[model samples]
Structures are given as structure tokens and as C-alpha cells.
Target: MMRIVVTGANGFIGRKLVRALLDQPSLSGADGAPVPLSDLRLFDVVPPEVPAGAADGPVTVRCMAGDLSDPAALGAVMNGGVDVVFHLAAVVSAQAEEDFGLGMRVNFDATRALLDACRQSAPDGAARLVFTSSVAVFGGDLPEVVRDDTAPVPQSSYGVQKAMGELLVQDYARRGFVDGRTVRLPTIVVRPGPPNKAASTFASSIIREPLNGEDAVCPVPAETGLFVSSPRRIVANLIQAATLPAARFGRDRTVMLPGLSVTVAEMIKALRAEAGDGAVARIRFQDDPRVRAIVASWPARFETARATALGFQADASFAEVIRAFVEDEMGAPHKDPVS
Candidate 1:
């Protein structure tokens, strides 16, 4: 039986990931045998809505809500030994940029504290830790297409925090403190629900709001492109990173997940294809230099040979991604699964 812990479990991706984990009968161990889940603890600042009847199932599901910055709160959540941990708590791009202090406390300080807790709790360093990093880690002067070997020159507070987190994960893995892996995720598009503080939130808002019969504002130019993954694919890749053998990551623990490079114009076109021009008409462009500057700094292309070879995948196209959000989140309608 395996005990797992998921931080930031209340988040959109975290909620979906937890449900996906519960759906799994068992996780594969290094020996290739099924490791039955005995207990699952979800930690966040807010209590996550657990899937109905999850506690009644074979796996014991527990939700702990409190600031991870508090050692006592974090310790209580990890009271029992944890076989696997997913660290997803963080401050988003725009928010982090706005409140550097808050970002430092949650994104940097809390992460370090969590790493220390994991180190102390699992002295043998057998814990499988999955840390979700971001493409924001790369900024300043970037190449046309970021590759496996590209060096991160972060330009924003959020990017700096994530870059620091990646280094911590790599160092912990090297010191045999934990079997850690980092997934450098792209801008996740079509995230369900209302907009967030992320500078990239508009990317989702433009599609999500209109599909819900509401108006949405796009702050960046139509020509601006982004390297993005859908929420579904991001969750899948995160799970894949956790299941793979530690040796598979080798010396570099950071895996840049695959994503689609779609311009704003192309994304809106996909929305039109699905909801017609009427839905497209609901979107308005309102340029903001601040948002544009921050978003534009992020690299919009990638060569993810490493993540691809490791069996990670991305969404096929923006149209399919929009359809997925409509079906899964909005309940608009279900389309055939894209290959």
C-alpha cells in the first residue's frame, strides 16, 4: 500500500489530478508491480472538494487545509510516511510580479520548507516527489525555440521563483534526499472557471468566457503566440513524471513538457470553428502594455525531444483543446477524442 500527498489540491489542475489518481486502480512501482494506494492526503490553503464516495473506497482520502508555510500544518498533513508527493502550490505570474513578497513566501520559502520536510521524513530518500515548474522560468533573451539544453534566464519574479524551485529539486535529487522530478509546464490554456491572476489567464478567458455566453477581453495582440498545453494533458504529464523510474531522468531532473505554439489569432479561429462567429463576436481586444510585456517575454516555441522520448505528449491542436474544455468543464458537448 502506498501513501501519497498532493499539495495545492484545491487548484483546478490539482482537483483533476486527484480525481484521475483515484480513478487509477494502482500505480506501477520500480519493480513493475501494482502499488495499491492505501491513503491519499490532499494539502492546500483551502479544503478541496473530494470526489463523492472517495472516502468510502479502498483508498483513504484525507483533505488538509492550511498554509503550507506553517511547519505544524505541513507536518500534520504528512504525519504518515508518504511514498509519493506532488508539489503544485505556487503564486501565478502576474500575481507574483505584483506582490514579490507574497510570491517569495509561498513559491520560494514554502517550497524549500516542503523539501526539508520530505528530506527529514524520508531519510532513506525513497520518496518520489513531483514538482510542477513552469515555462515562465525562461525569459530575457531566448532562442527561437527552447530546447532540452537551453539555459533559463528568467525575467520575472514568478520565473525566478520557479527557476529556484527547479534548482532545489535537482539538488535534492543529487544529494539523495529525495527521488525528485520537475516538469517545466507551458502556459495551460482553456483552464476551466474564471480568470486568475496569471498574466496568461487571458489565454483561457478568451475561450472560456465566450463559451459560457459571456464577454472576454484579450490583452495581447492577435499575432502574439504562446507555448501552451491543455489542463488535461498537463495533468497526464504530471502523473507520468511521478510514475517513471528515477533513473529515467538521469542527471537532469527537469523535463520540459511538450506544448502547442498557437497565436492568439489562431486560437480565436479555433473558437469560431466550434461556437461560430457569434461566440467569436463576444471577444474584445483591450491591449495592456504591462500584460503584453510580461507575456511576450515568455518563449512561444519549444523542441521537447527529451519529454517526447520519455513518453510525454501534448494536445493535437487548439480546436481539439477548446472542445475538450467545453466537454469536460462547460458540459457544452463532447467531441471525438483527438488522436
Candidate 2:
């Protein structure tokens, strides 16, 4: 039986991932074989909401809440014999920029500590570890198309912290301490809830709020390009990453997930196509140079040949991303089945 631990299990992506794991109760081992999942441990700074159907599912779900920066709390997180670890916790881009110390403690220190915990325990074998990275890792002067082999030149504090995490995971994996893999994700759009502190939050607000019968603001210009993917595709790719044969990752063990390359004007066009002129009118353009500076630093296009070959995918179109929010969160009669 596979016992897995998911840090940051209460966040948006974390909650969705837990729900997906409950529905499919399994993960892929290093040998590319099925590993039946029997236990799930959810770790977060706050109490994690247990998945609704967890009691009836085949997997045992437990929520462990505490400040991970504390050594005792960190040790407890890795207490049980673990087969896999999914590290999803992080400080958002804008928030990290505002509070440098807080970001360093949470994003940088916590990640290194968690990795040490895995190296200390895992008596049975090297645990399969998935480190969630971001496209923020790439900034400064970049080529027209960012590739899997492109070098990282982080321009923000958050990006720098994530870049450090990526290297640590890579070196640890290289040393045989753990079977580690890193996934650098793009901007996720049409998030259901209110915006958080991420510098790219406006990317979602422009689409989400208008559909929810509220006005929204577009801080960047109409031509401002963004690399985005839907929550559906992100979740699917996270799960698929675990199932892939370890050898496919080679020495790099990092996959730059595919994302749609779109401009702000195109997103509004798609939104209007789905929700009509009223929804289009709900969006008001207001320039905020701070948000623009951070968003601009991120590359809007990537050559994700490695991820595609590994079977990860991107959302079909921006229209579909808006539709997904409606079907999944806006009370549509029929919901898309778990992919």
C-alpha cells in the first residue's frame, strides 16, 4: 500500500489535487508500475479540509496542521513511513516580494527542511517526491520560445526562491536521496475564488469576477501576453507526472508543462464569446505598473516538447477555460468527469 503526504493540502490547487487522488487512489512508482494508495496525509499551516467523499473511499485521509517552519511540526509531517511526497506549499509572487523575510522562511527554508526530513526518514526506500515550481523561474532576457533546456534568470524574490528549490531537488535526486521530479507550471487562469497575493492574480479576476456577476479590473494592457492553463489541465498533469516511468525524466527530472500562449485582448474576446456583451462590458481596464512589471518579466511562450512527450497537456482554448469554471463551480447541471 502507498502512503503519501501532500503539503499545502488546503490551498486551491491542493484541494483539487486531494479530490482527484481520492477518486483515483493510486500513483506511479519509479518502475512505471501501479502503486495502490491506501493512506493520505494532508499537511498545511492551517487545518486542511478533508475531501468530502474521503470517508467512503478506499484511502485513509488525515489532516495535519501546524507551522512547517518548526522542526517538531516538520518531523511529524514525515513521521509515518511515506512512499511519496507532494510539496505544494509556497508564498505567492507579490506576497513574497512584499515580505522578503516571510517568503524566505516559508518558500526557501521550509522546502529545504522538508527535503531533509525525507532524506532522514524513508527507511523502506527513496520516496517519490514532486516539487511544484513556476514559470517565474525564468525571467530577464529570454529567447522567443523558452525551452526545457533554457537557463533560469529569476527577476523576482519569489522566482529566485523557487529557482533555489528546483536546484536543491535536482541535486538531492542526483545523490539518490529521493526519487525527485519538478514541474514548472504556468499562470493558472479562471480560478473560482477571490484573488490572492500572486502578481498574476488579475489574469484570473478579469475572467472570474465578471462571470460571477461582479465587475473586474484588468491591470495590464490588452496586448499584454500571458502563458496560462486551466485548473483541469494542471491537476491532470500533476497526477500524470507520478505515473510516468522515472527513466523518462532522465537526469534533469524537470518538465516545463505546456500552456496556451494568449494575449489579454484575446482572453476578453473569448470571455465575451462565452458570456456575451454584458460580461465583456463588466471588465474595466486600469493600468497598474507594479502588476505589469512582474507579469511582463515572465515569458509568455514556451516550447514544452518534453512535457508533451511525457503525456502532459494544455487547455484547448481560453473559451474552454471559462466554460470549465461555469460547469465546475457555477452550478451547471452536468459536470465534466474526472480526467
Clashes of each: 0, 0
Q: Which regions of candidate 2 are displaced past 4 Å?
A: 123-125, 334-338
- Candidate 1 local lDDT, 1-339, one digit each (tens): 888999999888998889888988477776757899889999888887767779679999998998888988988987988888999988877789889999999999998888888888889998888999988788778899999999998888988999999999999999999888999998888888778777789999999999889999999999999998888889889888999988888899999999999999999999999899989999999999999997888899999999998989999899878877877897666565542
Cα lDDT, model 2, residue 17: 88
Would you estimate the TM-scores of all the predictions?
Answer: 0.94, 0.94
Best candidate (score: lDDT): 1
What is the C-alpha local distance difference test score of candidate 1? 0.89
* Tens digits of per-residue lDDT for model 2, 1-339: 888999999988999889888887878765667788988999998989778878878898889998778899988878877888888998888789899998999898998888888887874337878889999898888998899899999888988998898888888888877777889998898788888777788899998888887999888999999999988788888887766766778888788999999999999999999898998899999999998987787899899999999889998888888887887678875455533
- Residue 205 in model 1: shift from native, Å? 1.8
Q: CA shift at 240, candidate 1, in angstroms?
A: 0.3
Q: Can you tell me which runs of candidate 1 are displaced by over 4 Å?
A: 332-339
After TM-score superposition, the amount by which residue 26's alpha carbon in candidate 1 deviates from its true location, in angstroms, is: 1.9
